[model samples]
Target: MRPTSLEGLPPTDNTEALEPQRTAPARSVVRGFMYAALGLGMMILFAGLAWSIRGGMEPPSTELETAPQTNVVSAPDPQIVSFKKGRLAYQVHCTRCHGPEGRGDGPDAMALRPPPRDFATRPWSHGETPEAIRAVIRQGIPGTAMTGWSELLSPQELDAVVDYVGTLGPLPSQNTEASDARKALLRRAGFEPVEPTIAASPLTFEGLDGRKQTLDQEQGKAILLIFWGTTCAPCMDELPSLDQVAKEFADAPLAVLPICVDEPDDELVREVARTRTKHLPLFVDRTGLARIQYDVQTLPCAVLIDPEGRQVGRLQGGKDWSSETVQTLLRTITSQATDLK
Candidate 1:
């Protein structure tokens, strides 16, 4: 018989229908929900940590930004640098023969005939201009110890050295200018008007009469100084003209001095003066002071000094010093007509 309640049910032929269905536990459901919430929280925490690290590493951002400005310093002058280079070059190559001060008194210069140029004197053997100086340095003098340096020095180096060499040259003296009228007279007389450089070298020398004489050319008195040597033939040949001029100017205010550049007691110098130079006093350099002070590179160089002790002009090589033109030159040099500005 079928029962109204399961509790009162009895055994039946189909017993599968009488079993109860299974349900999930409430504790297990609660535990699963808690685990899901924990997992979500962990994911949020990890994302926040990653963002914090990225923010710390990055640089702070600014609203406005621009490139930095810099102050630039100018470089030194190239010519100044080149000048220093040139000084070094001169010390190495030229000082051996030209002397440290360019006085032509180097130790090696003692043996060389036609001694190295004294840059202190304005007269260069070749020329005085910068271009002319460069030519001489590159091409060199044919019959002298000076050899071409084009192959040795670079173009820049050559120019630099030439500039330095100019520094060794003479400074302009008081009378640097000559009036046009005076200039014309000088040319006709074969006198190369000296671009007055240094002051007059003091005239302190020994005389042929065996006496120490310190001759000073006074202002308002004109004088001519002839630098000669007993060894030089050209200098010897000019003695007659010197004697003639000495006599010609004896009565005048001008004094013609033929200074002997030999030793104070040189027999040849004494003999030459005794036979050749009459009327003119034989003044010998006692200590070679004249050559050194006057920067006399070669013999037969005549310097004309005005009344003001200003060296007005120079005549190189031998000349007929007593000629009418020369006499006129002498007279003009002594005259007050040539007003030097």
Candidate 2:
């Protein structure tokens, strides 16, 4: 006889024991729904964040400009003195002007007057000997853009860089009498010595005097043919200094001719040339071919020519012609021209 009333049955404990089983599935279902809601909230939050970040941003570009990559020389034999450290230092300090391959074709090469040395080919201005190179590394070229690295680099690094520069050039030979004579004309700057000095190209240009002439017309006098552009800041800075030089040497044997590489009709160039370089003869390379003929790849570059119309050497960069060294050099050139007569 089972009792029917609630809490009356002794066997009710058996049903109570099975109650958890009955509720377990429902708790699992509730948990699944809660997990789905949490996942959906996370997805919505991430999508909104992405949208905000992408707004007002530039479209990704496929035609981006690529910069030069560091091309460190390969590993060398351990027996030899390692230039690895020097190369690393060069990349840090010198590559802006000296270039990755030490070719002097660095990105800043064109902008710098006395453009960086073309270690791969051309002669150096100051000196190219290891001792000389080392000294320059330590002391720097005075009044020029080259600065000393003694403070920034250690002696070991200096020595290593010198060695590295040593490997870059077969500096113009200084052995023969002809070589010596050729170098003599370069007394003004690191004018590249021409072994068999070449004839000056008959560059035809328009002058401020409204006369059209060829470079050969100035053949009888020693020449300072300067190539400049209106855009180069250094060229503008060099104008007054060059003007003073031209006036000071007016009666001298040298004929200072500043030639503009800009278009003949460029009004800005014309105005600047007339006012800034008043003392010098004005000429504009109208054909746009003079630079190719002169091999002038940089601005404020000049070619020193003998009265015979032969190119002695070229000077690259703006300069203070009034400086003692430059004046001395100019005087020497004048004296030599007088002797040539």
Scanning candidate 2 in windows of ten residues, the lowest lDDT window is 70-79
Shift of residue 218 alpha carbon in model 1, Å: 4.3
RMSD each, Å: 30.2, 19.0
* lDDT string, candidate 2, 298-332, tens digits: 89898887766667677788877678766765676
Residue pairs clashing in model 1 are: none
Candidate 1 local accuracy as lDDT? 0.73
TM-score of each: 0.46, 0.46
Error of 2 at 333 (Å): 2.5
Judging by lDDT against the true structure, name the best candidate: 1
Pairs of residues at least 3 apart in sequence or in different chains that clash in candidate 2: 113-317, 114-316, 114-317, 125-190
Best by TM-score: 1
Tens-digit lDDT string for candidate 1 (90-175): 99999889998788888799888778898987667688778998999999998888999989999999998887787677644434
Q: What is the lDDT of residue 70 in candidate 1?
A: 26
